[model samples]
Target: MKTLINFAVILFFAIAFNGIAYSNDECSFNGIDDVLYFQENSISNLREITVEACVKVNSFSARKSGANEIWQFIIFKKNQLDHFNEGFAIYLDEKNERFATSVASAKGIQAVIVDKKHSVELGRWYRLRMSANSKEIKFFVDGVLVKSAPTGFPLDFDSEELFIGGRTKILKDKDFEGRFCGSIKNIKIWSKVLDEDD
Candidate 1:
């Protein structure tokens, strides 16, 4: 992991100004409609990847779908319309009060969902980490390993645009409701699968 961190190429990516605000050393998102966009070229084509973020969720959206599906995205990059596609995402399952991470392929969405034991609470900060490769996907909360699952799929995806805090350009509509309401900071991404030691 150390060697990969040192030698592998890292893309810091662009952060476009949106409704989000940087205050007290973190970017705060209004649950209504706040999002940050990343440049396409900087975050595309990864075989193995690791993503980490420090977050404090203020509140989830009050609205719920007919099916009672509620999702609050932390990091998302995929076809907005389809779930079974080429991409990966990390999001909060608002209905279940847990964090979920998944990678998509033609086979379907392969996910590792954190158990109810690590439920996300309001106004508290959490260090969330996810690492994925062709063999497995692992998720962590703070420094503790939560869940690891076998997920054999290439991490590379077709979409170049990436989003943080919420799904891009879809917050106004209720059709794809996964806008996140939280404070996020110290986001790091690596184009290599990081180990537990990292």
Candidate 2:
């Protein structure tokens, strides 16, 4: 009887801890060609959403595109399109030294680019979170509110697959656009907008 009780206690604690971890939505990434893809029916008709990630940049440099150098960290992307104006993504623009969060709605591509006074340091871990509702979207870094912008319209997309660490190839010319050069972990996505308490 004592052994049975001890086993039950262990099982209870294990279940409780597992539930906590699942609610946190933790995921780790290798930051190379590594990508996480979600099934088509996993999420649909999202009115409000939140995405969070803890990331460490391994390097900061730009890939040459003719005369221009583009340095960016493609954090998250949903849907496929020929250009940046066709989908939703949250990325770090190293060339501009800012965080760019964009959503392609029926109106157009609405983006909020927040410039940081200090450049992000490589090899250091930072927590980045973006929350969006019908009215506005909020960007947070390390638990501090960094920027907020009008959402413009409801976020609607037809793509069934969601990509992490890089974007899905929309155009052949843009295929190489979203390769991140760092490590990402503890990625979480929520269907509803999260507030301070969440």
Candidate 3:
């Protein structure tokens, strides 16, 4: 009877170990050619927005070599035809090893804020959050407010696509060449800015 009980315990341990080893909770990007996009009809025309993600960066280096600064985008939605046009984006700066977010209005006004105080470490998962409204924009890391600033105008973009992990077109400078090299999961988006306490 004791031998049978020991076998059952070992069986349970094996199942649990395999479950964790093959977990598929996060989406991994190759930092090259791996991208997820949604049509504007599915997600667009937001007066205010909040984006949240659980991200673990594998690397911040660009695929191409000549760019001055490397940018790895986690979520990018902007005009496909125009570079740096009206839209919103959340990305990491390779040089600074920090998170940055930007919002643009249809009228060409733009606002950007970076988490200057916090530098993210590679292979560490972070709960990155950005909330933007007509009045202001806020950036949070791991539930802590990192940066906030008054937005020049409410974010309004007529982009035809919403991209996760990468974009359709490469920027002129090509600094953001590699896209994002990381695992992202639990991405949440809201039409209304969520209260901090919530």
Give the top-scoring candidate (lDDT).
3
Q: Score candidate 3 by TM-score against the native.
A: 0.78
Off by over 4 Å in 2: 1-32, 62-71, 79-86, 169-171, 174-176
In candidate 1, which residue ranges exceed 4 Å CA deviation? 1-16, 62-68, 79-81, 106-109, 172-175
lDDT of each: 0.67, 0.56, 0.68
Task: Give the alpha carbon lDDT tens digit for every residue of 76-145 in model 2.
Answer: 4453344444345667676655555666665566756474844577778888877876688888888888
Give the Å error, residue 147, model 3. Answer: 1.1
Better candidate by lDDT, 1 or 2: 1
Give the alpha carbon lDDT tens digit for every residue of 123-192 in model 1: 9999888888888888888888888888876565655567777655654443465677888887777888
> In TM-score terms, which candidate is top?
1
TM-score of each: 0.81, 0.71, 0.78
Write down the RMSD of candidate 3 (Cα, Å): 10.9
Q: Taking the candidates one at a time, how many backbone clashes does each contain?
A: 0, 0, 0
> What is the alpha-carbon lDDT of model 3 when measured against the actual structure?
0.68
In candidate 3 the C-alpha lDDT for residue 98 amounts to 88
- Worst 10-residue lDDT window for candidate 3 reads 1-10
lDDT of 2 at 73: 46
